[model samples]
Target: MQINQQIVLVTGGARGLGAAITTTLVHAGAKVVVNYFKSHALAEQLQQQFPDQIFIYQTDVTDKIEVEQMFNAAKQHFGQAITSIINNALVDFKFNGEDRPKLTNLQWSEIQTQLDGAVHACLNTLQAGLPDMQAQHFGRIVNIGTNLVQNPVVPYHDYTAAKAALLAFTRTTAHELGEYGITVNMLSGGLLQTTDASHATPQVVFDLIASSTPLKKVVSPAEFADTVLFFLSPWSRVVTGQNLIVDGGLVKG
Candidate 1:
């Protein structure tokens, strides 16, 4: 896919990592749909920042009906089938490892919530978009994953488990969709520097991560978002069902 020639939809695009991805896509000349569950004002602000490049829609990616409606509305608004989709919408979470539930004390509901937010959300969006992608016989899907699933240095039980589930689904879907010319992949990153979610992370933890990373610095959301662009662009057309870890060599996989 040519960045400037694709119609893109990014879920959870109102703030943080999603926001960075949306901005990068728009600037690269792709027409982007910004999907948000809340933060309408922030969405509008993004609209004003980059005029005529994006459409803001408030929808929950976890809901089948809403996901279908978003894709439909995107086609109507952009006058083209969405050629690329970024499943970046995350369920609300703060990256405070200290407060995260340990295995012995973890509640099923907590795990379920993460699953709903990550895995279920991806399923809803992928299913809703598949028909259009099949009709076009061309599409790109990128799911945001985490390095924790591989490195898991912090031991965020529920969160890492949910991301692992998403990775499994990503690969399975890619295999099924490969014949249709749609590629599915995951871009996993380590602790981002200062996103709303990571702001809650302790400075000591950040220092530890930076010191241990090959780059000796925490990955920024913008940097992670740029890696997402690679999957969406023509350079990666032959690649699918792979997890590209963009954590400065933190996790070898």
Candidate 2:
């Protein structure tokens, strides 16, 4: 799991699961670029805490130009070659409780927003980061997915659909890029206990999930971060295009 001297980029790295991933990468001896859309204050605070190891940049990953600029800025700071990326940023996870939209009433705008965060963000990062990895002949990409796509007991139609699409894209890209020594994989988890996104979930819903799981508990962001870091490390070189679910054995794939 040695990542010494590697430069890693994490989208939506300002807070929540993304923040956990960023912290893990930095602590693992990799130079980390934390990409945030609006959490400038938190990003700056994190950078201040790890001045020499962590860098922060603001970019809307849904936009091509912004994504390119983020990579360029990161390269300028961390050097031209980035070795890994963690796609963890997402739009609103507001469809949790009373606000959840039924499939019949789901608006195109709502669907598009989720798609922008899940699919488009990954596309932007892959398009921008692949060339550098290809040129360097080594790269690791880990896209964050959700357990809802498998269980769907709660039924977040838009979010689940978008993540399913992300998994498909990750597999296709992994196959296409394997010849170049680049590995693309996905990490999917369920009901992370203490993130801003998970806060929207109802207490009863979360409790049910926890009790039903073999582990009888929800996962922490740091726990999920561990899996992402594993993928980035040298140990996972032979693993690619697979969706690894870390949901307390709630959904066995």
Best by lDDT: 1
Model 2 has how many clashing residue pairs?
0
**Model 2 pairs in collision:** none
Model 2, position 76, has a per-residue lDDT of 89
- Tens digits of per-residue lDDT for model 1, 139-232: 9999999999988788888889999999999999999999999999999988998888899998998899899889999999999998988998
In candidate 1, the residue pairs with backbone N, CA or C atoms under 3 Å apart (3 or more residues apart, or in different chains) clash, namely none
- Tens-digit per-residue lDDT, 1-253, candidate 2: 2587788889989899999988888888888999998899999998999999898999989999999988888888976566788889989876375778987899888878999999999999988988888888899999999877888887788888899999999999999999988999999998887788888778887789889989898889999898887788778989999999999999988
TM-score of each: 0.98, 0.97
**What TM-score does structure 2 among the candidates reach?**
0.97
Alpha-carbon error at 94 in model 1, in Å? 0.9
